[model samples]
Target chain A: MDTNTLTGLKSAFQVAPSDELAKVICFALIESGEESEIALYLQQAQKTLDESESLKLAEALYQAELHETARNVLSEELLSHKILVAKCLNESGEPEQARKLYCSAIEADSSLESHALNRTFNVEVKVAQINNDDKPKLKVVEKMDLASVTDMVRYRQDTSDFSDVVGLEHIKKQISKKIIMPFQRPSLFQKFKKKVGGGVILYGPPGCGKTLLARATAGECKASFFNIEISDVLDMYIGESEQKLHTIFEKARSSTPCVLFFDEIEALAGKREHSRNSSSANVVSQFLTELDGFSQNNEGVLVLASTNVPWAVDAAFLRPGRFDRMFFVPPPDKVARKAILEHHIKGRPAESNIDFSSIASKATGYSGADLYNLVEMAADEAIDESIEAGNEVVISNQHFKNAIKEARSTTTEWLTTARNYARYANEGGRYDEVLSFLKKHGK
Target chain B: MQEHKYTMASECFHRGQIDRAIDLLRELLAEEPNSADCHGLLAGCLLEKKRLYAAEYELAIALNLEPQNALFYVLQARINLLRNKTKSALESCDEALQLEPEYLDAHLLKSDVYLVFNKYDEAKACIDIAANLQPGSVTVAHYYGEYFFAKGDIKTAEKYAVDSLSIDPQDEAANILMGKIKLRQGNLKEAEYHATFVIIQNPDSNSALRLFCDIKMRRNIILGGWWRFNAWMASLSNVQSSVVLISGYLVFMLAAQIFEDFEYLTVSSLISFAWIGLVIYSWVGIPMYYKRLRKELERFSFNPEF
Candidate 1:
């Protein structure tokens, strides 16, 4: 671990510039506490090392309490490195600089904004602690106020019920029985030892109205709807994501007769083994605890989650008392497709007696969104014809035919992937609904 | 504005962000549904994702809107090739070539379809035309290597594969061709090296997996046979695999009934037992192959020079 040993390790790394050799050299330098040697090694390897290798070396340096060295090793060009450098700066008591770095990284990549904002919050807290003043606390409060001003979640009180949703009568009936009835008659459910609030997961292909169904269910029960986004929970700091999740659950619990709708729930509850980092797994674990932990009462706080890929979700989330009620929101059937087409074309100028059935039959695998696109396409066709003739022309069957030729269903790919999962990985028959739909649709 | 989005979508597609490209194209198509370029680009993205039916539908629309577009015909040929309709694929390629006789992609695709049909002479003619069109193209070199390999000229194939790799070492087709050539030469280690290189970059690549299985079989006959068979099964689409399994079952049942009708009770029982054994082998083969592949990968990691 001395300078000679460091030199020997450097020579070995030079012979084989692999990650393993670089790691060995880093550990050796850290063990010897040779600051000058570590600086020299960083300066030499800066030109030769790739981004991943530099990140590794920076991580090792950070672990050894060499914050400045770690910051020097990381490149400012990469957003990922910027976050790590911000952490190093925060550790070295440069909270303001760290906050600036986080802000810049967030500006560069909006996907990292939530994580950066959480870090900035932590930095404000640190600055307050260091200054021994209440003014920093006021600044923090002002920042929180600003955040609330720009917050996306509105706690909407939608008035639309199942009547607003087109087609899927069977799904609506089931939702009414499993979710709505419990909320409407909680005391009766308690008498029967049935919980009023539990987890229900609605899974289907993209643009198949899972979110719409959740909103309708919330309206049907006359409950407050809280749409939770992934950004609302995930944080860059360790354990902060879990804490944010707990706070969300607590907020829902405080407001009874509330529906917490989480779309793309798989991002939060994906299988632990599939996660690249422990933070994601911890978030999933925290989610499970919030769902059905000891000393937790979720009555009148229904959780509705939807995902396009239910197979990617963790199995533990589907156990009884968690997301036990799994509903598959399939692509609109032929009848449903006709209804959706009619619904989309209601306000548009069109022929009075358009043959909707022929159009619907051609849109076999179209989702509600795809059908909406088809109508838009047909309207475009009509508009083009009107422009050519210098007069407004009503959309006709010919326009529909022209639109059908260009607009293809987007659900077929999802069904194809889902079919594989249902056939091979249908553990506990969780994907039985998907399998049945595929069979009936001849997918 | 739609043209800008189309350009952006094409950039995303080239950068391997296919889902993003598809989203951008869909948005553009929503605004201008009659834009054949957007539909064709979306079809290309779908083809890359292996959503063949959707890709075909989109390409058909693109062709309908612009029947004279040779690019749409080439895209159609690619979809048909993936669907295993070699004749239709050839026809589409010929149509594209007839529209634009010097089109390099159409010539290469025609060569590929001819190679699939084992028409080595036709494949060679197409490859020759392609090479003349793009003499220094890595793709043309790879196609020439494939043509030679299909013709059983291993030395020439190896030379062309080396030539292609020297020009672009990361070319997947060239690496697969080199792996196949190495396999033909009975150089199992080199073949494994080439296949593993491609598989590490793209684990979903069926050709690399097939070559890897072949190399494994050359090393150990029994386990390798199972691995090869499983790889072959996995290469098929869900519907195709199901048909294969059902046809296999029907044949087994037919053989058993014939044995019973001939009063060969022992033969019939043996046939039934053999069928059961084969089914069991197929069932367990997947997990076993994966386990063995993991061990092999671990060994490969430990000895990087290997």
Candidate 2:
């Protein structure tokens, strides 16, 4: 407190016991208004002040009172001391000093960067929160909710003919659980009894009804359905792609309870690993954010995401809540084949001699779509035969037997991929069905 | 007086040690009775450092010498915005813009001034002109993040921040901005991580420390500050600062108290505490009072409302 005591302390404890001591001394000067004396003591104080003392010193210098002296104190070159001085200078209306210290901070390290240092209170706030009276009536767009939709909706078909898909009642029930019920009464889903909206992946061989399943899922949601293809959003313009993404999400969010079906997910949701170019990476990143960016307000929209290449989405998206549910759309087993055969033969003039059950049993590995085509090809052959014989007729069992010889499933490669996926090779293959199917048939 | 072995190291700087030079100039201002060039140099240095008060002092002295220098007002405005001083910075920037509307840096500086003032629309407008002046410049991208972060869209805030960083990875403001967002998102480890880098760059970094203190406060347990490190605890923890300061002083004091008859440890601890006090407050308990206040800041979590 006295000059003699100050002198003794300066001589006795010159180097910082801790940086905090320096901070305390700076505070002492500010409170005492003894700038010259404080400066002298600061000069005499030790450089290797231990961390605590340095922090204390920094704190003192940083406070409003000692702020002016803190600038001089910061000259000590100790990183902690310097930071303290900069802050003190900033408080003491020495912004120039503060900025210099900030620059010095830049000068101190080769790596430190200043980003959005100008990042405001939160960000680019366009509209301020208005009180009830100050708030203008919002035109609550009852049409579309784009924030809930991905910018890239895989657009292939209108799905008006989408009603053709049948069978898989449980999968349909899953669609209701996964998309419909969640939208109808979102408040009912509880933890334990909770549902984390996950991205849905329909992985199956090409003709195995992946698209059909997606369509039914979309239709069942009964929300505004937008089938945004990859090409619909991505463009060459620098800002255009972002705008398109913005518009798509904006539109989707407005249409709450909307179902956006993305077919051939690999076209857009493909893993960032294979994308060597920045544009593709941008597309993926923007697309990922759009899909997952639903703030707490997005109530009605449920994304019915499907991908043949389920392995391609970014790893970040697959973490926890993004897209958790994946279904394995495999080739029809004998039972499914029989059901498919029964459905396809509904209006056909088949005689009792056809023996369709035996036909279905023979058609293992045939997907529903593939089975329908197989039967159609068989019918075509019969019609061709009848035309030559100059008679109206049914496709006989013998004719189908002949047709079966010419028919080959286009799903061999698809089965291998599906098998790999089902095995959890890319995480797309984590299903037990693929392992069992492969165990029975061999990888 | 000493022979210089490392001339390069001895040299002021490649970019120049403007602040140190300004400090020397301020010191010289006491002795020099009338030196306009010195004042101008000091102003220039202060302006370069973004220290507007000192810079303005020099500017007033310099304007008396040469009234037609448009760059001085421009620099003043730049200082104003960058320094968080609005009225003067804006007025100065406006004068600069009016004199030479096409002046690119001046325009950018005006936007910067507005941005610092939280006048986002004006800042954005200024940036619009600057963008027209220099399309896709890092400055525009930089402020783009700034405005967005201020607006509260962290996703886009991060997006623009990333964009700005991509252009100039060394941009300190962008990095700090990114670190702030990281801090707000409940990732103190990352916030501390980034702040550490920023702090290291400028030990005198007010912004970095502000961010760092905030991050440290968000932690799950006790560390740093008073009971930071001790001989026994230092063995377990790697934060060398704690190992050295918080523990070292207390140990010295306890030893001094315990061995008062011997007297060395007590005297040593007293001296250690005094040294810190002098460095901070000239032997006053200024750091103590601030500690109580800082405790409040340390408690500030990202409630979004704040």
Instruction: Tell the DockQ for candidate 1.
Output: 0.02
In order, candidate lDDTs are 0.82, 0.61
For candidate 2, write residues A1-443 as lDDT tens digits: 66665555555456544444554565466556464455555654536455665556545555536565555544547664554565576667776766666566646862442443213111232345668766454433333345434435543334432356555555666667766666556677753366524366676667788777777666655556677676776666555565676677666667666666666777766778668577777877776777676554434545556665655666666665566677766666566677778788778877666787787766656667668887898789879988999997787888778877777655554554444344324344355655665566542
Q: Which tens-of-lDDT digit does each residue in B215-238 have in candidate 2?
A: 655673253332222212222324
Worst 10 residues of 1 chain A by lDDT: A137-146
Residue B101 of candidate 1: its Cα lDDT? 99
Clashing pairs in 1: none
Instruction: Give lDDT tens digits, candidate 1, residues A270-348.
Output: 9897798999999999999999956778988999999998877898999999999999998888788889989989988
TM-score of candidate 2 to 2 decimals: 0.37
Clashes counted in candidate 1 amount to 0
Please provide TM-scores, in order, for all candidate models, with all chains considered together. Answer: 0.44, 0.37
Local lDDT at A84 for model 1: 84
